[model samples]
Target: MAGAQTYESTRARVEQYFDRTATRTWERLTSDAPVSGIRATVRAGRDRMRDLMLAQLPQDLTGARILDAGCGTGALAVALAARGADVVAIDISPALIDIARRRQPEGLPGRIEFRAGDMLTPELGHFDHAMAMDSMIYYGAADIAGCLGRLAPRLAESFVFTLAPRTPLLMAMWRVGQVFPRADRSPTMVPHSVKGIARAMRRAEVQGNLRQIERVNSGFYISSALEFRP
Candidate 1:
C-alpha cells in the first residue's frame, strides 16, 4: 500500500495494453505457432524461467494452494496443476483470461481456476506459495515493494516474481520506449537493481528474507527473479 496510486496506474496501463492490444500476440507466443527468430528466443527464455521457478518448489504439490500471478495463457497454471497444485491463475486482461480458461484442459475442474482481476484481491483467499512471472516489470521497485507488502499477509510460505534488470541496455530501451510511446505496444518495463528493490522492501516493512535468483537472457528477453519467505 506504499505506492498505491503509482501501482494502480501501472496496473491499469498493463491491463489495457495486454487486454486491448496484445491478446493475439500473446496467444501465439505462448503457443507452438511459428514466430520470428527474436520472438523465438523470448519464448525459449520464458520456458526456461518457468521451469527454473517450478524446480525451486516441491515436486509433489498435492493440497498446496498456489497463486499464479499474471498467468498469461495458462502455461504455468496448467503445469502447476499437473503437479497436483491447486492454482488460482489471475491476469488483469480479460481477453487473456478468456484464452487461459479455454486453453485449460478438462478433467481438472478444481485443479486451476482462472480469474481476471488484481492478484492482491483478498477474495482469492490465502495461498501457500505464489509466482508472479513477468508481472511486475512495468513498475518501479517502490511500487513493486508496496504490492508485495499488501500480498505478504495472505501468503503463508513464499512467493517468487520476475523483474527487468537495471542493465544499461534495458535502461536505454526503457527511455526510448517512454520517449516514443505507442498505443499498441506493451507498456515500457521499468528496470530495477536488486539492492534497490531490497531496500524498498525493507522500507515497506514487508517481513521476509529476500533472495536473488537467476537471471535469464535470450536475445531480447532479459529478466531476473526474486524470492521472499517469512
Candidate 2:
C-alpha cells in the first residue's frame, strides 16, 4: 500500500500532465498517415489495442451508459457514442477534454458528454461500463483498490482497464516517486505487477479475465476487462 495525494491535488497534477502530453498524443492519434515505417507499424498496433477493447463490449450499445475514466483524447468515448452508447468521458485535464470536444462530431446521432473531474471522486454518475486505459498505473495498491471499490457499484455491467507490466525496476521507480512525484527533468508512471493488480482487484471484490495482447508491433500490453452484475 502507498499513500496518495487527495483527489483534488492528484487531479491537478494529472491535468498538468495532460496539458504537457496531449498535443503529442493527439498528433500521434489523429495523423492521416504515418511518416515512417515505424510509424506505419505502430498504427496497426494502436488499432489493435482499440479493437481488443471494443470486442469485449456488449453487442448492443444503444442506451448503454458508459464512463471513460481518464479518457485521454476521448477517442474511445467518441467511438462508443457513435455506436449509440450514452457516453460520459471524464478526464483530469480540461485542456485535453477541450481538444477532444473540438475533435468530436458536431452532429453525431448519439450524445457524448465530457467531464473534467477526479477519478477517486463519487460525484461522477453511474454507468453500464467504465474504462480506465493506460492511466491505471497512476495509483498504488491502496489507492487502486479504493478507486475500484468506488467504481464497482457505479458500473452497472462491466469495467475495463489497461495496465503496463510491473517489472521490479518499475516498482522501484514508483517507490522512489513517493518522495518526488513530479521530480527532475522527467516524469515516470507507476506500473503494477500482474500479481499485485490481481490481488488488489480481488480484494476489491471485482472479478475479471486478464489477457495479453501482442500488437502488430513487437510491444505487448496487458488488459483486464471485468464483467460485473448487480
Candidate 3:
C-alpha cells in the first residue's frame, strides 16, 4: 500500500472516478433475477461488514432511525431495516442507489429510505445512529474532520464510522511513490493510523469509545462509536 493521499485535489479525483465506475459496479452487484455469480461477491462483502457492525452496536435497532452513509449496494441498510431500524441509506452514486433500492427485500416491516448524495454535505439530517462502512477511504485529511463534523449534529446520540488504518509501513511506501509523481500518482489507500484517528475524533469534538478489530486476513478497520451531547 502506498502512503495515504489526503490532498483535496486527490480526493476530488477519487470521487469522480467512483461516480464513473459506480454504475457498472452497481449493475453487476444487483443482478438478482437470475442471481449472477458476481452478486455473490457483493453479498459476501456486505454480509461480513453488516455482521461486524451489528455486533458492535450497543443500541437496539428496532424503530431507531439509522443513517447508512456510503451505503454501497445498501446491504447494511437493508439488513439494519430487517433487524428493525428505520434506515436512511445514502450514497453518492445514483447507479448504486438504484441497485440498493431494487434489492429491498419484500414485506420488510422496517422502513428504509435510499438517497443519492454526498456524505460531506449537510442535507443528511441527524439520526439515532449512523454508520460509514469502508467509505471514509475516499476523504482527504483536510475533509475528514469536516465530513464527520457535519454528521455530528445529525446524530441523535451516537454514530459509528469504519476506516482503514494508516500504518507506518504503508506511510513509508507512500512517500517513496510521491518521488515518482508521474509513475502512478495514486495516493496510498490507507486513511489514518489509530493515533491519527483519535486526533481526528477530538478535532471533531466527538467522544465515546474507539476500537480496532481485525476483520480479514491481516487488515484492521477502526470503529469509532461516538456519544454526542443532546
Specify the highest-lDDT model's number: 1
lDDT of each: 0.90, 0.64, 0.62
| CA RMSD, predictions in order | 1.3, 4.2, 5.5
Candidate 3 — worst ten consecutive residues by lDDT sum?
217-226
Pairs in steric clash, model 1: none
lDDT for position 179 in model 3? 67
Residues 58-101 of candidate 1: C-alpha lDDT, one tens digit per residue: 98899999999999999999989988999999999999999998
lDDT per residue for candidate 2 within 83-191, as digits (tens), equals 7888888877777777788788876656888877776567777888887766665556656665666777677776766655566655676678767655332335667
Write down the lDDT that model 2 would get.
Answer: 0.64
**Candidate 2 Cα deviation (angstroms), residue 21:** 5.3
Worst 10 residues of 1 by lDDT: 101-110
Give the winner by TM-score. Answer: 1
lDDT of 1 at 146: 83
Pairwise TM-score winner, candidates 2 and 3: 2
